[model samples]
Target: MVGREETTMFHRDLHPDGRPVKPEEREQLLRKVLPPTSYSDETTRSTSPKPVGRKRRILWSRFVTRIHLILFAIIQAVFSIYLRSRYLYHVIIDRIYTIMYYPHRTPEYIRRDVKALSRLPTHISVILDLHSHDRYDADSSLENLVNDVCEICAWTASAGIPVLTIYERTGILKEYLQDTHRAITQTLRSYYGQHPPSISLRAPHLQSISPPRSPNTLPADATPPRLEVTLISKDDGRATLVDLTKTFAEMAQNRKIGPEHVTGELIEQELSDLTMKEPDLLILFGPNVQLQGYPPWQLRLTEIFNVEDHQGVAYHVFLRALHCYGKAQMRFGR
Candidate 1:
């Protein structure tokens, strides 16, 4: 019965004439229909030997990886050392230059340049980085500060700059304005053998209106020209702008005027009445270009110049700053 069933299954592919297929044809058809038998795991294991060079390749890869890591570390170390050497070299060179080739500007040369400027700034402001004060011995730092202030005063006196403002970050100058002013004036008088200028000191809270002067009232060569020296510090802060704006807003509310009526001219006039006039040129003496929380309202149209390492800075450096400012083409919000 089993043989008959198998024959029936095989006969399903027979020709329509009902003739049984030939043995060679039936064998070929069986070969095409059946799946090939797979080898057992044991047979594969016996036939295939383990790859000969796998361990060698792994060891070589590890060795190469270690070599790459070692090279990268060496390169990193070399680059770090190079950067350190470069920085030290630059510092040494800067010190050498300061000791040897730094140019000193004479009072006559400064005066000449001041006159040569197409239009001299009416007011000049200076920012001193007192954070650097700890770099030197306390006494030496104080002496240097005095000398720097005196040098600035001498420059302003020579250039006939009428208004000079000084700012420090921590109120150091503001706290010692009387002592600093006395020292600066004494140094100027001793050095120049004449009164330098009328230096009027004012605090941030103080308000004083300068008397109006008619144009052409003062001669060109006015000796000991009226110099207004204003000293301010962090105590003033940026609240000057905020306070001014608030005052104007309150005023507008009280007067029942529109906020648009509060114009910049009016704000500036009020500020001038409270503080000194806005600075035209701001000379920052430090390693960085940051203002370090300087009054923002005054710097809107100001030209800024930076001097690196201003402690015991050369006079020619100050002159060069002025020269740069003179060459600058100012477009006051054109």
Candidate 2:
């Protein structure tokens, strides 16, 4: 009885008329008794938002959004058309060039085509993307990539570009290094006779693969007549830079190479020794000019070639890339 009285006294509702409150009336009586802010004043405040201004703002925002979408759609359509047209144009031109330029008969034929160029790259790097119409299956894409590498290697060899590096971002080429070497040998044999230019197939960390010298070829020497073919991947890209940095840090700590010894020339020399030297020309087998992570450090003055909407590695595109490289004047940051 005393407890009930105490509770009633604490929660008593005596708003103006001194009314005892029920559960339904408790909130109202308490609010009436308390000093309410202007926003909460039941007599003066509105719970719903104003309709006219809000609706007008919403309508304006929707209208602007619609305009942006339309503009974006139009721009996309135009760009798609441009890419398709450009790809077709290149295909037709390349087809025409093949009849006159592609070395169907012999390696000498391709060499003749190469001879016409004002200059030729000593080292050529081809960026091979592991992408194809074979979307659902990865194995199919890998085969296509291998075939692309084989074809490009043979072409570069025929063009007499002494050094070639195959850049596939995934490094699948390096993973299947032996198979790639065998395939390249077969491809070269198809182009040349049994004894093609010797290909030194090597990846970054693996042992270099070189087949036995055919009796029909040159005598055993310190450096035989061979094509230095390298396989590089994303690991050889920025990852190499990071690794190099770590190595330099360790070396500096050990007092081997000082911090000042880590100049651009020093890094370049180290990288060249570790990997291949900077390529003179970089050929992209894809339709557009996307690096797709070719080593940035190696591409300071490299001549890069791209054909819009063109897909796969074509011999004609390879030839055209060479032509483009020959014509390009490397000012080297002039």
Candidate 3:
């Protein structure tokens, strides 16, 4: 017996009335049967176009970069202008001062004046600021300082300056005395090889004057002069001052002298007796003109000249300092 084939129903074709459905209708029926799912706002937004703030942020970033560049350029321009103006001001001022104060003083005139005055200062002291070591290139700065000292010594010798004292706060010159002496000797030999003046470290005692040669010494000044170089440090000043005070106190106690009797002159004399001679001229090589703890007693009548940045200092600078010293008129409390 022939039987009718049984019909099968797929999930998409299923309906309450048992009728077949199209693809679109089946999709709609499935959607109604399933529960609704919740989606995050961020997920939904990400699927759409970016918001207005994104374009604004991009524009703001570009604006900030341009502003930074503009600010940097402006700062550089201002700094350049300031430096140029400063340089111009210095040039104008220097020219005016030179014209007014040094009208007849040509370079040759200044040099001659310095040479003549160099012979006058029996004891000249150079004070170097050791504190500037950190600010400069160490090796180059030291080399420059050594060369400067050597040149100054040779020049002093040439000009018949009898004694030179080099002072530093750290005793650096004292520590390098041998090297300094050798450098000075070399410099003198290089400059005046034929008849180099006798340069030696000054002894602690007062230098003795040679007795007149057989009473026919050509006015007692014809003999060749000697160049005595002394290396002094802050330690010398401190030690001398301490010793001087102690001695003065002891003498006063023993002699029953009052405080009024121990005058500044007395102290000065005592210090001079201890240290031998006071400096006639004191040249300071530093940033400022003030003496950085130099021996107070020695500077009573000393003419001080300041030259900034002693490293690689030219011979003309030293000559200029000497010229200044020569021109200065000291009243000494007239």
**lDDT of every model, 2 decimals:** 0.69, 0.80, 0.65
Q: Write the per-residue lDDT of candidate 1 for residues 1-334, one digit (tens) a residue.
A: 2355455646785644677667886786576555554545667777885676677888999999999999999999999999788767756756664564333434455576567677777799888765455565766666666677777877786687888888776766665667776776676566455534556666677543233445465456755566677877765656776787787778777986687777888877777766667788888765568888887777878889865544435555566577788889988778
lDDT of candidate 2 over 53-124, digit per residue (tens) = 799999999999999999999999999999788878887887797777766737778888888889889999
- Candidate 1 Cα errors over 4 Å, as ranges: 1-106, 113-116, 135-143, 207-222, 252-257, 307-312
lDDT of 1 at 2: 32
**RMSD to the native, candidate 3?**
13.1
Give candidate 2 misplaced runs (Cα > 4 Å). Answer: 1-84, 214-225
TM-score of 3: 0.56
- Which has the greatest lDDT? 2
Error of 2 at 59 (Å): 14
- What TM-score number comes out for model 2? 0.73
Clashing residue pairs for model 1? none
Rank list by TM-score: 2, 1, 3
TM-score of every candidate: 0.64, 0.73, 0.56
Question: Per-residue lDDT for 110-163 in model 3, tens only?
Answer: 335465563467788887655454446766656666777787787677556788
